[model samples]
Target: VAGDEDLPVNIDDLDADFDPKEYDRRMQQIFNDDYYQKGAEEDDVPEVSDEELQ
Candidate 1:
């Protein structure tokens, strides 16, 4: 998505001149929670709130 957006940092400029550690953090922060889920929802909540018992 290069040239698509004009920002202070260029993600692909790692070899050229850019702090990967800083950029990595920024990128993660931007997509944190909003872009992706923290983890599997099922891990926290059970598949069934209440299962039928025989």
Candidate 2:
């Protein structure tokens, strides 16, 4: 499944320092619907003593 006639290219290769802010915003908007907010809330809670990792 490897063909070069219509190859996908790296975005970074096209523009060495490209920052597509709108593309980023759209992705964040999609991902922010659930898990992102939940993660933020979880980060705010304190960890219990016995649950601490080695």
Candidate 3:
């Protein structure tokens, strides 16, 4: 669509320096932080025992 049509011309404009590792590391860090924070807050809630229902 945009300029990415099959109109190849020069190799200099090509972005062959793409890195997926950096992107993965950032996503993992954000996920870990959110998971730990939620766990800490939920620990205060009461839990029902197996025998409580009887």
* Top model number, TM-score: 3
Q: Report the lDDT of model 3 for residue 12.
A: 34
Candidates sorted on lDDT, descending: 3, 2, 1
Candidate 3's residue-wise lDDT over 1-54, tens digit each?
A: 145343332443344454588556544754566556766886886879989968
CA lDDT of each candidate?
A: 0.53, 0.54, 0.55
**Model 1 misplaced stretches (Cα beyond 4 Å):** 1-17, 37-54
Can you rank all candidates by TM-score, best first?
Answer: 3, 1, 2
Write one digit per residue (lDDT tens) for candidate 2, span 1-54.
134332324465356655688557545654554646655775896767865763
- Least accurate 10 contiguous residues by lDDT in model 1: 1-10
lDDT of 1 by residue, 1-54 (tens): 234243334545555556779678867765566334434452486455454432
True lDDT of residue 53, candidate 1: 39
Model 3 collision count: 0
TM-score of each: 0.32, 0.26, 0.33
